[model samples]
Target: MKKTYKIKVDCAACANKMEEACKKTEGVKDCNINFMMLKMKIEFEDGVDKDEVMKEVLKNCKKVENDCEIYI
Candidate 1:
């Protein structure tokens, strides 16, 4: 499944980092962050709980970009 959420990121580079972080997270098959739109699109793995997975995605994104925010 795929979903899009509002995101807060300071710059394009940080958005790239967030995208990479999200892609590396478990339960995520793919990810994209658009700095211009301040949004994140996530493609989740089959049968995974999106809410729980997004929690981890947000946590992982924070590791690389501490000030970034993803609205659950």
Candidate 2:
């Protein structure tokens, strides 16, 4: 499944980091962050609990960009 969420990121580079972090997270098939739109798009693996996956995505994003926010 796919979903889009609001996001807060300071810069395009940080948004890229967040996207990479989210893509590396378990249960996430892919991820993209639009810095100008302040949005994040995520594709989840089949049967994965999206809420749980998003929680991990947020955690991973924070590791690379501490001030970034993903409103799931």
Candidate 3:
């Protein structure tokens, strides 16, 4: 399944970093971030718990961009 989420990121480059971090997270099939829109789109692998995955995504994003926020 795919979902869109509101996000807080300082810049386009930071958004890109968050996107890459999220994509590498387990249970995430893909990820995209729109810096202009302050949004993130994520595609999850089938049957995964989205909440759990999102928690991990947020943690991973934080690693690359300390101030980034993804409103799940």
Q: Can you write out model 2's per-residue Cα lDDT over 14-38, one digit (the tens) per residue? A: 8888888899999999998889999
The residue-level lDDT of candidate 2 at 6 comes to 98
* Residue-wise C-alpha lDDT for candidate 3, range 1-72, written one tens digit per residue: 999999999988888888999999999999999999998999999999999999999999999988888887
Q: TM-score for every candidate vs. truth?
A: 0.97, 0.95, 0.97
Q: Considering summed lDDT, which 10 consecutive residues are worst modelled in model 2?
A: 63-72
Q: How far in Å is the alpha carbon of 69 misplaced in model 2?
A: 1.0
- For model 1, residues 1-72, the per-residue Cα lDDT tens digits are 999999999989889988999999999999998899999999999999999999999899999888888988
Q: Cα deviation of 40 in candidate 2 (Å)?
A: 0.4
Clashes within 3 Å, all models in order: 0, 0, 0
lDDT, residue 14, candidate 3: 86
| Colliding pairs, model 1 | none
Q: Which order, best to worst by TM-score?
A: 3, 1, 2
> Cα RMSD (Å) per model?
0.6, 0.7, 0.5
